[model samples]
Target: MLGASFLKQKKALEWLSALFLFLLLREWLLPLPSLSDTGSISSFLYLVAGIILVDMTFRSHWLGLLIKIIGTLVIFHAAFVEISLFNPEWILQTLQAVSEDFSRIVNQEWTNMSIISRNLLFSGMILVLVSLLNYLVLEQRQGLWFVFITISYLAVLDTFMPFNGSGAIMRTLMIGFMLITTLHLSAIQKGFIYRGTQSAIWKTLVVPLMIVSLAIGVGYASPKAEPNWPDPIGFLQGKSVTGQSEAIRRVGYDTNDKTLGGPFQQDDTKVFTITTNDKYYLRGDAKDVYTGKGWIKSDKQLESIVHPKNYIWNDTLFSGLETKKVMAVVQAEGEQLPAIFYPGQLKGIEELNPENTTLTYDTISQGILTFNGAMQKDSNSRLFVERDDSTLIPTPVQQYMDHYQLQAEIPVISEKKIIAAGSNYPKDIEERYLQLPNSLPDRIKQLAEKITEGSNNPYDKARAIENYLRSPGRYRYETKDVPIPKEEQDFVDQFLFETMRGYCDHFSTSMVVMLRSIDIPARWVKGFAPGQEISRDANNNMTIEVRNRDAHSWVEVYFPGSGWIPFEATASFTSPLQVNYDRLANEANEFNIPASTEEKEANKPKQLDQMEEADKPVVKTSAGFSWGWLWGIGILIAVGVWILWKKRQEMYLWWLQRKMTQYAQDDFPRRFTLVLTIFEKMISPRYSGETLREYVNRLQISGDERQDLLYLTTIYEKMLYGLKEMEGKTRSLWQQTIERLLRQMKP
Candidate 1:
């Protein structure tokens, strides 16, 4: 029943042909490996050979199954051979390795050999599925599977990681072939075209050409989507380096995540060492919101510093505070561009080499100072921090807020007591800090409120929540099996209830949520922790060792009068979110000079001119052939050749028939008259009054011509009077005799 219902009713040969064409076109569309790279070429060819072997196994005789399997194995083994194209020893080794260490090869990190090996394995597995398909299902179901495989191969290449190549023409040709093949199958299915027909000129040429033309026309006529993304087409194709957006950051990574997330891992490479008596969290940056799906951007906090002037000498240091200035010289060990690790606030930066780098702020991670390029070796910079009471920055420095905007500013730090500046806080700050997705579980908010119960003020409530996370038996720093929540599943809810196990991201993120649940403003902060001490000076300043293992995430709470205070919530580590440096480091390094008012004004016009110079496009003109025009000419030549090929048989017959018709026009009466006329030229010309028989008798002619002339004379006389049609044999005879007579008569 299965065979009769499907496979028996199907056109096996046609489907096989179509699938082969699909594979061939697909191979053409993908990136080609370099000819010298034997491994890559062999890997690709291995897929092709495997596909053929699998196809034949099902389609050919059942008795040949063992032979097909061996052939496939031999080809696969040959592809994996190293020094020689065909090595028996390497084949044995590859067979052993694939059979024994397949799992190890799959789990290994991406390398040249691994990438090619995995590709070979994946393609081989796909063919294995194809080989089993015939035995498992009917042709109707198999047809669907074949289509799915073909489409999935294209979609994965097009979607997952686009391989850049010739884009439109190859795609159009592939589409054309698919359309033509489909038409052939459909036509044969419905009996529009016969199964036994040897040629399908209409299907091969006309139908496919029409489909391609229509496809192109519709594509141009259709509305185009907006270019919201960079390279909406497959031309610029690769997966985002961050597997998904905003993953946990590691040391030696030049880029930091805007959103803090984990399953965190640590590296032991030191980024930089600091020498400061006060052990405080080296706050790198902060994100204000928890996007349940994990793209936590503080758009409200995002001031673009779009221009260089915004971050460069654009603002003066905070002045309304009784503060002790601290300076530290951070000399980088390696060429890694270290994150500007300042204790309290960044006063200024001076590049050791003016040509080295320019610093920019990612308003996302507040303290991250991104350089255009990596820092040079032995590069060092000085940062000044004030160890004072809680200082609250009402808003990020947008423009230079100098004398006019400084109106009776409340002190950032004081000798006596900390201040609550929330009365003066902008409404935007309050809203941005307390943001939580609506999908956040109510139980999470209840948990936060429960943890912070009985705390009278925001700071006390925040401290209570932080302590709760770092509580002795609450949670541990575990990376293994860290709960990755379902998309709709609340991350905090899962960590807090189902599994009370997580890393820095989980603890810090939970603390922020609990703080926000009670209407207190809180955000996530990430950077290196107060690192381990390496050495101390005579004055009691100790240099520290900060490594990737020291990379951490913590929370920050927003107090009304006091700004953002960093809070450490992870266990097995300790850092005061709010750090106080009563005295500066004795080995104080000078801050890079802030531009004076007059100097800034003078530099303004010069900087604008320089920016204009940088923005301008550099154009260089050279003479060469225009490839667009050349391609147009080539396309036209190809079209002309195609048309000629289509009509070649008709053209050949037209030439032969044209010559025959011309020769035939001089037959019967015309030939006889031409003979007499040539005779007239030879002898004395017969007057118009002379009879035809009389004129012929007067001619001196050869024996065969003379014999033919008497027989032709009677026929001509009858044809002249009667307009009679000559027989086929007589007409053929007359034409040859006349052409021979004309040639003999030539001078």
Candidate 2:
């Protein structure tokens, strides 16, 4: 008879386990509401109750397994769909809407609530009442009615009251309630016996009494006024720009000045606008000479010269010119400078400079023309340049320049000097070129040598190095945790030998230093990478916004007949078409600057020679850090802490029930011989593996006794999982319980 009774008990427990597994699977499959939602909490309670009912009615393992599998499949399907369709933006918007509505209802006078507020209040009230009903069911099962009621009231008060403002107090109370309620329900379903000495009435009464005491304590605490809502615009305005350096630095061009900083900074000031019919290149100051550091105009002295007879110029003068091109006036943002960038070679500049508006040059080998002093605020600046379509034409020479004769006055250097500086190339360029700081690493030079081997000419060497650095096999853009050191010697060496991931600066700087070592007069050029091509207007004018992401740097090498040609030596593989003027113009606005008769006449030999002296190199400073990094780091740390706390709560609940089973088996020795038992009853072995603690936890207990079991279990789990030592009362209770249970269970 005893053996038969044991078999029946084991069968019942097995069926119960199967039912619990099925319920868990079902819950996972459905798109349940967030834990905080009242409706979701109610649904969860019903589901748990349903699982208990099913376990009582069905003892078949096959039926339980089938239900579990089907439920798991449903959940897996939902998870897949959720992952594919997840939109963070929608979640944020919903939270914002909920918060706003809640705030409005709370602040409004009861008699004067708006329609929206009233509706929201009514819905919230309904949820609260339903939640209360669920709490009652939980209390009945656990026999902790007074405790549940008191805790619910305290939580509701904390959520709605002005005390402590909108802080963690409310959230903590709600979480505590959830924990108590879930523990109560799980215990009742599992048939666990509570071993606590305290009666249910006393345990239930103590919670309400404690809540009252807390309410009294809070009333005695310091009083503060309600927090006012912040103005969204004002909040945005107060944000520090220094914190957003990368974002700001991306758009680093001053449309007005047509000059780029060797180092970029973030500023969103608009420059000027353009409305044009034909596509044109917005010419910044042309750089014809490259030092090891950066780009500059040609070294040759400017000579005054008459305008070439074959030149074609736009007709636009100061305000309005009848031209096929479009025109636009752009405004500046913050302290950002202004600039007008157009496609193609400029025909003439109008109202930019009184002394030299018309720029009619036959060709610019590698040099760019600038309207001096035209960057000043009140000065009317405009670039009239012809668009060059052969930007993609390959090496030694471009085909577009075939018809144009080389000017006699233009400086002609030997091909060797142009390719590799003369015998004095290293010595002459050492101070400005091969001059890495004493702190620069030896490995940087080694890498440079490795990349440029066998390349005889400056152009070929530079190209070789650029291709190697830019190849997909060499670099990626992931930010390194331990960044390459900024110390002179360590920076480049670390980048080349250790962490090979970095942004454009590291690559360009390395390229410049290497070229200088080999007698090449390569320099860094900083400007917007390339603006997006805007749609053209009816008249064929395109307007572009040179945003923050456009900031870029590259090397410019001098070519004999063509002036300076641009080459990107960084790891970024931006296509030439993306940055090319004609292609961009074809997609965006094309403005034509008309050449005035006086400007055309003024572009004589005398003027060209006179203006050449102004093309000399100038020095500038570097871009550095602001105050935003601190705040970003703080936000990251806070998010990490919240995740840890949530995980701790889950582990605690799993441990509580395990300990309760130990208390239940203290009176029967043979019946509790083992916490977990394995018996083979079929072809497939049926083996059950569970900890003594886990088996104890599976039984459902209620009221004061249930809380006691939960408390002990939670403490034990924390000790075991957290690797903490059992201490004081908890240690004593665990020792006594184990001794008593083992003594009783001995055969």
Candidate 3:
């Protein structure tokens, strides 16, 4: 009858409901770090387990008050140690450390508490909370407040932080509603339960449970409406770029650079990978017009392409220049880009993965934009289509290219030919490439002239401006805390005179603006640098992985006889393309001064020369904390725990026997009671009105096992009834009997 009472269905459901409700705390605790500045607590799952175990043992009256306390402590020990619980030394050390933390908490030094103590304290708080919930749910039959609070917490997280609480919210509603309904029904049928009509509680809950379940199902299945307003969190923290909203600062490629300023954090998200014979800058697009704030494309026209064809080139500058064919294969890793990243002058597309993907060229930017199917319109639509009403609509492609092959004609640049080919700018090139906003500060132009005072040709003047911007003490490379231009300030002016520090965009924009100030036709070009070499083959072909951190921008100077030549003006960066400085001085000795051997050596192209050594500078071994090591340790701990759990019965039997020997010396009563308890637990639970003899007889044991069990039961009966004293022989027999019975008890 006692066992039957413990198995009361309604009571079991009450405990289950309380446990489920308490587990919801994980949803709140797990995302706390992401929502705040706190670091993640690693043992959070163990803490939750400890709390649940303590709650279960405390509420289980059959275990007796003393055993319940011991069990709770054992659980705490396991959670705190996270190692072998039987290791006395480790357990003692953990207890001492945890105790010290408790002292700190007592002194009101909350911040001084270590992670272990905090988790321990949090577990204690949850133990109290679950007890209170038991009273509220089972005794008082109320849980509306808990449900309401859970909803509010999840709603706040979903609205503000990156935490997606939508699934959690749905789950919370389902469970919370059911819990509340069950508690309400329990309250309504309390009188019936008191009168011993236990089925009344179950019957009363059936309809409410069904109703709650149906309501949850219908609500979940219903279509959700789009958010009625713009994201409040984004509106507050996001910056306006290209007339669109973006995160405060995260390094990546975006179509708009109309407003480019502010510190950006590095993102390791891989954008693409390239397989090629040599390193080259992967050009995305170029912006011809600089608005003093950022860049904008002058021409929005895109020319369609169905097959491989030479890209648009400034024939006046690139005419008859020696070119080498370079083939590269690019595999997209991140989101589909609006344009393909090509190296050098794009000759044409050799192959595409889908074989049906369409391509178009942005005439002004010279960027190749891809499409899913054959373009329905004259030109392929951009990712963001600007309508006539001045509103932008995003056009998502159905299929993104997996990989594409490119056939490019890389122009072999000659510094001698570039300098000797005087700046006889074409009408169109002069109009477009030499553009500068009217609002540009006059001091900026003066600074440009001052920097290039000794320069004669366009190439030399451009080189002088590049060297000045990247020169030490004048500007520094920085990606964080870079200030944006004010309404009255020019972007380039602020970087050049005030901040004097920025990333690639800052130096590149400044170089372009400075070049235009002196009538040197240069434009701001953005792409990825020669990314880190990830692997190399026997044939010397290299595999390069380009991440968001590799997203960069630079200046491209358009010389009439040399086409558009790429230049690197950012500090700590070297251009892959080489210019022959020795030949330049020999070709025009009167105008060009010979550079020193050291300078000429530095200027030599290191594209192929540095491929083998690329991994050395890019990869560094650190003696720091690693998640991989932590995961490995965690896996090992998990396996140990699983093994212990599987052998729990045998381990408990061993521990019981060892403790019995110790208890016999000073505390025979404890030893006797413990033996009887193990018998009831391992064999069968005691029933109401059943004597010790009757319980033993019900076990129906055979052979020697039956005798051992009966003898242990008799000792338990003697201790419980009147026999308060036992001789040494009787106690020894009792211990032996209990040990033998435990050994014979198979799990």
Candidate 4:
């Protein structure tokens, strides 16, 4: 009975030791979060301690199983929390929102909270929850299976879900848990016999040595921060509270107090400064579609060619009014120069020059001119272009009609012959013309109906809507706060009825929808608002700079003889948007101060003056090694040294043990003493100098024959010298020898 009890106790101790070894392997191999962050290290250590206590307990069989189950659950819970797989959708959405909010916050836009703090808070909460779950469910052993199932479900979700930062973290944790579990199981099967003998040496020397080496390496690799770091703020830091005003003023635009600084400042200077020799219209944008809300470009099938002859030009026959010509040098400051230089009528364009230019005229009403050159190049230089805006002759219209086939394809007008005037418009266009949103405000519709009560024709109704919008009673450009109801479908309805204050998008959308309600063909047109004038360079050229704030959208209305006409229906400015030519020239002269100084010093002629300076060579410096690199290198070196030292020590010990096994006699007592001496040397301070005789005398055996005593000692010696291959066989022999010795030997 006593032997059976001892064997059972030994087996339990072996199992407990095996469990701890498995845990140690897991921690070493996997990239789990540090013990500090997770409290996992303490939990695991406590679990090992608990196993030891259970082994000593009177009822260790059940108690040991309970402790192991609890410990395993705790470990699982910690891993789960670290990965953060719970409520994945909410987590992803929250992270996305935080990223967007961080962008806004960096730009000085409104954000509810700091993104970093939010992320940290969320991570901490998850960590705490995981800890709690481990403590409650895992410790109690009541929900171990449930916990496993939950983890499995989360793992599946993580695989199927879209890639995200949180999902990545969760996957890492799940993989870690699986690896740890596998390693732990393997270690448990290996048993704890070897580990029990080796633990003291590893704990005292091996682990501490590794930890100290790593610490030293880290200390050597870290870099010190500079005592006086240079100020890193850029040009914007020097400007006033309204830095946008300074930016605008630098571009030769007058800033107003109401403009509001930062990115929203509106420059009052004209984008283009035109010096014309003749009285001709400088057209900018063309508005073709006539929504009840506003005028926008018409949606006509884009033709290969966009010229005046393709559409109605004027109401008269061929006349000499076409001779009204103008040669203008127009300098633009902001926005790209449109190929259609103006919105009104034009006859011809000549002598057009741009540094980087591409012209595309697919729409009959307009052309796009994209300047590929830099805006800073044409500060004050004059670009000469001739335009002829004259009354079109009826003969030209008749000639155009004779040249191309015409059908009354214009929407909402009846069919008629091609003519300059009195042509019947298509009636079918009227039915589909007015298409308003179903959720448009009743008040807005009522207001629109009231404004165009007497209008019969589509043109008249469009005019009424345009006039009503342009009038003082409608709207302004000031920012207004309006909380949109959750139930609202269309943004236009909310703006027109509730807010009544918005930029071009709101106004244009509202206008188009309203016009559709009243059987008018209208569409939205997006383009750049006029830019401010900047200094010009030599060769008679000027620059136009367009910023993001200049984006504008409006509406267009089509007319019978004139084609699409533009109308400003949203918010009218006090002054016409134009670039100040004189101011731009003055700024250019001011900018030329340095060049003028050099020219005067060199006695060079003013006519020979160069506009741009040559580029200078920049000094280059390579970035030195970073702290992270140094630390990595240090760690590698430390690990290398440790491995080398461990290898050398292992080799020395192996050579010594081999020599002892070969030379030492197979005398059981002597061999046992040699093994004990080696173990004492390996363990150092903890090991006492206990000889075989002393140890045997201390155990107080009742009776032991010389043979039994020799046999037990021999088995022990064989195990120590690694002569015995199987621990179980050696242990069984030791036990039988011990029993006989105990029966025969006296104290």
Candidate 5:
């Protein structure tokens, strides 16, 4: 009743609603901890406060003031008298409990806010914040400063408590909109923002409509890459680029979370967008340690941090000779903070932003890219790499020379299974992927053998098991009602026998354990799924939007020459059943791996130098001038110019964002001013005779395209002329829309 009545206090209602919107974003997006943890506690307190505030509002001024004073005194007296609010503890004990939760968080042992010592600490903070918000927004109308103050606090807080893509993006947008609301309300109160404009009412509607459109574009237009989560440990350790290779970092992501007993909770917030030459499963972090409870990231391997240029240019040093390259353009969804993800073995990574964020390579995982800090909003990166799935069926083997893999046929009389069986993995792979806890059940082994009864080789056995579980109607794909196994029952055992219900992690983890039981080495890998392909380019490049729900886990089985082969065991996401596997074994090709190597290389362009050398004809002339040469050079230059024109806006925006992230002050508002000034001078180039929108009008663009440009110009005017702050999400949209316009139209 109290929580419900708090809304009756008009002032409390406004700020409290805003706070709820911010808090509930977790439930909407990637809520790390369940809502029942602290969220519910805080909510309950809100209701109680609502009743009190509402009742007090109806009282006379003196009575209301006296009641508030009495309430305060009572609370203090109770604290002094050692009275417990929720538990048998005094105020000091509650404080100690909150302190313990913080310590657990710092240790990275606590699973977010789920099992905190006490809820009163956060509940109390929320109550105080809402009270202050009400006074500022309703009574004093001093909401703008408070809004900025909160945002600044969150940014610093985020370094300590990093948000997922959804959490971060939602936080930015909600706060931004609320800030705009407060600004307009305050302006109206002071005769500014909301004081009727001379433009048509429809003209005023343009910016809002533009925001809606840009929001949609940001959702679909960005490129999806591997998720780079926030690093709390890294943040605390040092701001330097150097760090160890922890498969799991402090990135607001913990796959080892114990979700065995409860329903699966998914967050569908947009993470990143991806555009690629060909669609394939993206490679992400890998976990080798299974502690019976959950996967733990151990083995802190280290490699020297390398710059983007060094990684790309010296490919032979990292990936070896004659490797296939899959080019991808990826966009991370965040404000100025971003993360990185990729598919297969990455040869190079090019960030659109200029932060010069160096990537650390996991010499162990080979393909994984690790960034030191969060990336900027609309930050795009290009990946030159190779995926593991190959058409050449790996030479199945149980025995091979230590140098690499060599084929041999093994015959077993038990089931008269005779097949080639000598595909060998690196020694390190065998040790890591084959490691299984003693608690793993025999049921998993029996099931693996039963599933692959007739299969005579590792590839065949692995494929048989994978295909069986992936077949529809056999195991349904779901995240809810997953049974929490008893203390003695293994997680895999429960899913395979009792529940028979699970999601990607369950399926993948089960598959890995089962394979290991049968002497087939496998490990678990995770990243966001390749989302809906929205558009395809002239070169058949695809654009996809990957969200939080798309985050997935799968199996990677190691094979020499083939690398770590990605296998999909999830029921709903299996690829084609039967494609000719041995067809891609090319004794003639330069690059290794079988399946998609030829497919990937066929579409890739030959080097210009090589092409020229191949096509060169003997032109006997005293002078070096030839009409053919002139024509070829002209064509190359035109193509280069065309490419540059198409990507110019993205290039500019990335450059601007990169600059903002690297600022010594990193004061967002100040950096925004500098960036906006530079954008106008360099990109739009405001002239002496033309108004901002007039300059755009001179382009003679009309209809939808003109509306988009006009919207940007309108926003620019408001931001330049009006005393409003640029919302983080809005800034991301502005950059995206401009880039979209540049790509769509010739201008």
Candidate 6:
């Protein structure tokens, strides 16, 4: 009965096949958002398919074509423009923008195109794809190739990216099998219609459907064991430094840094906001041990600290340093982290909420982990607190420290002081910071020594390494497309010698490792850069909003007298930590600490005209003189040529008629003669001895051309041979006849 009903509808099986193909196509789009910035792709694709199906269903071809055009325009409007589709003014504006961007694409200025233009192009491609799918399913009655390509695409994404394609694969398999079955049945139906026969295709489909269902059920229900062989892809890609495989993860600060180096998308989710007078990097933690691939902590001992009584910076040993007190307040706005965040050289905590919050500071990492209430310490220095005590049971650490205030003593040592303080060994610092893997390549050390060849002191050596890594064209600041180092490759070695492009981790790690190779005590520090300033309060304090995108890492070089100094080694990034170069410029003549070239240029006083020019906004100019006029002239010429090519036949005919009319005003005889010459040119010149009447009859021309020439010959003979002077009305009739004859000739 079901098979009979499908055959009765005539179009049911075809539509069913198309619907199944649509579902299969949809699976290919499911994982797009995770891999790119495109969002709501499924909705856009659905809109396209729905409109295309509507277009295919219309009875009138012209009407359906018109509907398809309008529907495509509507989809473009919805996808790229944030306005109502019915607004004619905005639609025109959007189309103009698209046209301008189209020219940019023609010029191959791909990077300059805005995101809107790119998405517009994507929408156009989708429109074409759906239209093609229409033919493949309804006309060609085949979609097996499309299904195979989609499965391959999804399988690769699943293997390489964080996308899970198991469910998509199952759905695709089911839809593909059904779609093929329906197309076959529809083909059988078409044959029956052609042969004037009748058959129920649904009856043939029932057996395949039952078999597919049983197979799917058994495959889904069957107990499966783990693969006998390990993942071949993992072996091919090789293990990370942590001896484990890693997939690309989202960009943010996480507790784990055991495995590093891969692509990550920017996350703009705000984590915290800081209000302070001066910009400072929000330090999270530090890692001392380098495993050639990533950083790890060698020490985990936590020291307890209570606010107002104990200062975190008191343990540091330093001398001959200029410093000032700075203060900041951090407010947690997003998901709270498990640790407390502070700036450099934390003096002490002035305020913490709930009055029962406990802070444990890791001596090596300098990272502060928070917990509830007064807690006792185990032999390992881990915090232990009574859970049952009503007073001790405090609010969540994040909630308790949701908002806090602290003061930091920022060091501002000049280059002269740093250089004068020679290398004085701190045994623990040297042991921890100078440690490198035995397996590290020797070229890294050689490169370090080569970079710092002329430098005499540790400070100069460190600066040399930092400058070399960040020099223009030597390295690039890329967030994504950074590959994880293979098992045999050291992360820093590969970056410095092989890839030469990556994010902060690549540059910072290379610098730290290089510095270590030359015996400069350096450690890897991870934190947030001084974030973008959102606003300033009435008191002149700046409020900076820090997001996950602001997460960064840098090299911290320790000097004997000046303590640890932060240096930025990432390309296109500047260190926020300020150094007062002029403070000791004249204090020590022997040391002669010349300021960096950048600082010298920055310190130079500007003249009145120079200052005025600097105050003005800079305008971007093209290379050399503008040739905009030349481009305009070229475009005009191109337009004219195109018009001539498209309408050459009509223009030629009009020109010939205009010339005939001009000659007719003065002499109708000359006009008639010109018509005869034109007709001769169109076919062939009269034979040497042939007269006009003979030429017209023997021309071998047929249809309207032959008839027009024969008629005109009679008129010309009457005027020339019969000597019958034409009246005014007869002359007009003669001219009309000539014009008709000319129209019959091909341009």
lDDT of model 2, residue 671: 20
**What are the Cα lDDT values of the candidates?**
0.47, 0.35, 0.62, 0.36, 0.47, 0.64
Task: List residue ranges in candidate 2 displaced over 4 A.
Answer: 1-347, 353-441, 454-456, 478-485, 490-494, 538-541, 573-747
* Sort by TM-score, top down from the best: 6, 3, 5, 1, 2, 4
Backbone clashes for every candidate come to 9, 96, 2, 58, 33, 0
Tens digits of per-residue lDDT for model 1, 5-65: 2222335444554454445434532332210111124334545445544453353444345
TM-score winner, 2 or 3 = 3
Which candidate number has the best TM-score? 6
Writing each residue's lDDT as its tens digit, candidate 2 over 282-354 gives 3343333333233444333222122322334422111121112223333233333322333333343332322
For residues 610-678, write the lDDT of model 5, one tens digit per residue: 000000011011111112222343355445445644565565455555655565442434453444344
Q: After superposition, how far is residue 74 of candidate 2 from its true place, in Å?
A: 56
Pick by lDDT: 2 or 6, better one = 6
**Over the full model, what C-alpha lDDT does candidate 1 score relative to the true structure?**
0.47
- Tens digits of per-residue lDDT for model 4, 551-607: 355565444443443333454321111111121122122111112222223322111
Error of 5 at 636 (Å): 57
Which residue runs does candidate 3 get wrong by more than 4 Å? Answer: 1-247, 308-317, 376-399, 582-606, 609-747
Q: What is the TM-score of each candidate against the true structure?
A: 0.36, 0.30, 0.45, 0.29, 0.39, 0.46
Evaluate residue 120 in candidate 3 and report its C-alpha lDDT on the 0 to 100 scale. 48
After superposition, candidate 4 runs with Cα above 4 Å error: 1-264, 267-271, 277-328, 334-340, 355-358, 371-424, 427-443, 458-460, 479-489, 504-509, 525-554, 571-747
lDDT pick, better of 4 and 5:
5
Q: Give the per-residue lDDT digits (tens) of candidate 6, residues 1-747.
A: 554422223377877887887788688666654333233463466566775576457645566556776777666554444446666765555566568778777785443344445555555555555665666455555567667877886776565443446778888888888888998777656431223333446767777888888998899789999776423443454533232224546567777877778876556678888888666667888899999879888878777665533564663523467654567888887756767777667777877765677777787777877776665566765566646543433233432357788887555567777887778868988999999999999999999999999789998798778767755456755544478999999999988899877877888889999999999899898877766566677776778787776788888888886678888776545455545444222422111111222233343321100000000001001011111222333355345445654564565456556767666453655676667656554456655567777877777666666676666667666666665576788667666777677766776
Window of ten residues with lowest summed lDDT in model 5: 608-617
